[model samples]
Target: MKKQHFLVKQMPPEEIELEKKRAELSILEDDLALKELDLTTLQVVLEDLRRRYLRIVGVKLAQLDGIEAQIAEIIARLDPKNEEVKKEADRRRTQAQESADATGSIAAEEYEAEPFKPSEDLKQLYRDLAKKVHPDLAPDEQARERRHRFMQEVNQAYSERNEDRLRSLLNEWENRPDSVSGEGTGAELIRIIRQIARVHNRIEAISQEVENLKESELYKLKMRVDETQDESRNLLVEMAAEIDGQIEAAIARLKNISQRVEKTERSRTKQRDSKR
Candidate 1:
């Protein structure tokens, strides 16, 4: 066989630099997608825990508040002439009603019907959609706003574990006018550079948000509850039980106050009859 020579064309410096920037942009996009997904997942989990906490512990707290209000009402009735007592009773009643309304609004089985656990396929789709349509990747403020709205729906679908909706959103983005890209090595490089900056800013924002979430009081309590779960201790149930004890004590106090108010009324009636 005869030896043969083949030539390889060297790319221009600008072209080479553009290629490098493109590679960097690709990697950043991937990182941004993953980070956004993680942040969304954390938010969904925390929100679920919030609902569970309201349902379990908050309801009992509301009940206890109601009993306290009852006690306050009885005390006020025993001294009808005291404005302070009547005002305190009204305040307690209002507080109890608000707490009851707040707790009652959380559905008892809202999350139990279907867990928010996303399958691997669902996660993959979400990551793809996030990378393709992230608002920071938009070229202008108007485009960014549009992307923001679209991404909201995407995030909602992902949180709900709606794979079909996510797939539909991906298709919708592909067909959207903004999905088109312009070409020209120099101009493309400028665009890519701007994109890189935007993506970096977005990634940092996601990090800050995730940190804030982790530092929240609710998140701390959730972590403690999870830690106790590993040790076979149901902290939420225990919390509810603790509240139940308080509720029982409050009920007893309310009963005692009610009995006192009745006895006072009976004695006053007897005195009025004797005077007549």
Candidate 2:
């Protein structure tokens, strides 16, 4: 019975150690969950900002350009040698040019920084880091610490959307970290790297599709059509400005609409945030 007692005593210590390890793992899992949720929320905010900026700037600029084009077309149809027509065309042209410049400036201001990094380059960086610091190969505490540092670097680079920093970090990891060999570990690292690469590739493809849609012939034609309409409307205003009453009435109406739209946009934004 003395040998049986020794075995039972040995089992209790192992069980206690197992429970401690499980508790540590639970804490780690909770931390990772919180980090993931924060990351997802940030991504959503970024995407929404991009969409809002594009809609406001792109659509409005297109409308302004269309207005200018229409004014120009109307002016061209008027006989150039006639003093009234000549003066009208010159005035309308100046107004159209001013409107175009304003729209262009707004477009420039609304531009957002492009996506994190091109898929291929980002994937390459991920692969190089995975080779050096993959957790499976880092069996000891010191090695694990190094792996954690490398992973932090990877996440930082991604969050900042800094391709240059990511490339430098990957290069540093490849040069400084201990190398691993053997089929199983290397294969596992490759698999994880490939998964990251696939995600980057998909993001790049989606971005490209969006850009292509924006630049399509149909889109260009619609812009041109709108520009023509705006120009025509502007030329009519220039022509009618010769009649004082009409010019005053039109200016007043435009001012009213502009004020209303501005107020509505502000109210809508406030409502959106409140809902969130």
Best by TM-score: 1
Provide C-alpha RMSD values for all models, in order.
3.3, 20.3
* Per-residue alpha-carbon lDDT of candidate 1 for residues 194-242, written as tens digits (9 for 90 to 100): 9899999989999999999999999999889889989999888899999
lDDT of 2 by residue, 1-276 (tens): 455544433545545555555455444334433333334334433453344333444444344444544444454443345677667666766765665665565566544444333355554555455545444335345666777777777766655556788778877776784644335544544534443443345445545654664576544544453475567643223323344454355455556655666677789899999999
- Evaluate model 2: give its lDDT: 0.51
Model 1 weakest lDDT span, ten residues long:
107-116
Query: What TM-score would every model get versus the actual structure?
Result: 0.87, 0.27
Q: Global CA lDDT of candidate 1, please?
A: 0.88
Residue 211 error for model 2, in Å? Answer: 27
